[model samples]
Target: MAIGYLGPEGTFTHAAARELRPGADLVALTTQAQAIALVEDGSIEGAVVPVDNTVNGVVLPTWDALLGTTASRIVADTLVPVTFNAYALTGDVVPEVVVSHPHALAQCARYVSSLGVPSRAASSTAEACASLAPGEVAIAAPVCAELYPVATIATKVEDGAGAITQFGVVSRDDVRPTTDRWTTVFAALPERNAPGSLAALLTPLASLGCNLENIVARPLRGSVDYVFLLFVTDLDQDREASALDSLRAQCSGLSVLGRLAAAKHSRPDGASGIPARLAPVRS
Candidate 1:
């Protein structure tokens, strides 16, 4: 089977892809949109891409792409722990500039700030490592130091050791739910905005006894309107069908983004036993 991912290699997405389907043929696309496009075009069977980061929050591009695409659906979800390291070419002089992907830079903001140098965004952390000059530094995965000719100057630079990112495996086929604790759907609310509109849409889930996991809203393109993406659980075939019926009645458009097994990681203190990273959005 062939899979696509955002890359130049040495990216966290690449790591996630490998973990998702080890030994599968992997295609590296320059952008997340390109990876999804390949899946849409049937150039590849699926694509693994980051959707959210523990510290950096939602990845806007992936969310926007999910909202816009119709040919692909999320097949599985995975959480990869992240640790960033600052690397530089061998030199006695301190680096004058730092570079990395925006998310990586954000995760290591404190360390980057301590460097007291200007920072620039790269297409990917690997790309940044590949292009670094003698007096420049790249914040990237520890593996980058070996993949590219750089030395690790700092380690575990992320804000916390708990740093993790949520990745989705996207394919053209609908995946059957493997566990009761599975499934997430994306729905677009009606164009007309009014009081309690959001609540009305969510009422069905509550009525059906479905646990609303994560809920995020993104502004519709070139408009003041907004659309919500929801992750839900505690649903069976009958309940899922009923919930969809209610949502279809209330929404302008509805799409089952994906349905698969949920992640196994969970916080010991969490009441729902859901992974802290996947915990439901509370009011």
Candidate 2:
């Protein structure tokens, strides 16, 4: 089956896609949202989209897309180390301009500042490398050097060490059973302007033994209310049913995105170590 990724190939998402679905034909798309939308529309079997990063925090566009999706859910997750490398046309070339995705440029802010060159944003790091002009350097994945006609001018150009980006593999189909610890993700629209609304919505999770790993808020469109995206783990099947019932009674709406194996660090063997399984939707 074909899988979509935020790409032009040679991107971190591309790497994650390869790690998640080795030997599957990869379709490179321009944006993470586009990749996810394709899966929602059944144009592709799945798509790997960036969800979070160690250096950059949550990927906002991805969260927005998830909130909008109906048929698609994040079936699995993977992490890709953000190893930013500076590439140019020639090995000895000095760059007048630096180009990369905004997130990549921001992660390598200190390194880019040292180059004394203006940094421009591109659609993707790999795209920047593919479209590199004379006297321009692109901060991109190390794999770009092999895919594009560019030489690595500097390695590990990111400001920090061990920066990693988390990608969610979205699919419409229910995932096969797996044995790994699972986390259920969903978005909740709590009652607007109600006193103790947010707290009331989340208290049941703690009481039911589910650990809330991460919570992010996005503005609910055309309203003052916010949609809370929750990543909850330590779930017991028996307890979760009760938690869901309590959550439904508290919130105006809940979109159970997926129940996925907890993400682990990317291994040296290029495995994410996460497995996939689906839980019944409680929306």
lDDT by residue (1-283, candidate 1, tens digit) is 6898888789888999999988989988888788888888888899998887866777878767766688688878888888898888874649799999999998888888998999999999999998998789999988887788888888888765667788889889877667766666665565367888888888988988888877888887788878888777767778778888878888887878766465635433343535788987899
Number of the top candidate by TM-score? 1
Runs of candidate 2 with Cα error greater than 4 angstroms are: 264-283
Clash pairs, model 2 backbone: none
Work out the TM-score per prediction.
0.88, 0.87
Error of 1 at 118 (Å): 1.6
Best by lDDT: 2
Residue pairs with clashing backbones, model 1: 213-280
Kindly give the stretch of ten consecutive residues in candidate 1 with the minimal lDDT sum. Answer: 264-273
lDDT, candidate 2, equals 0.82
Model 2 residue 102 lDDT score: 91
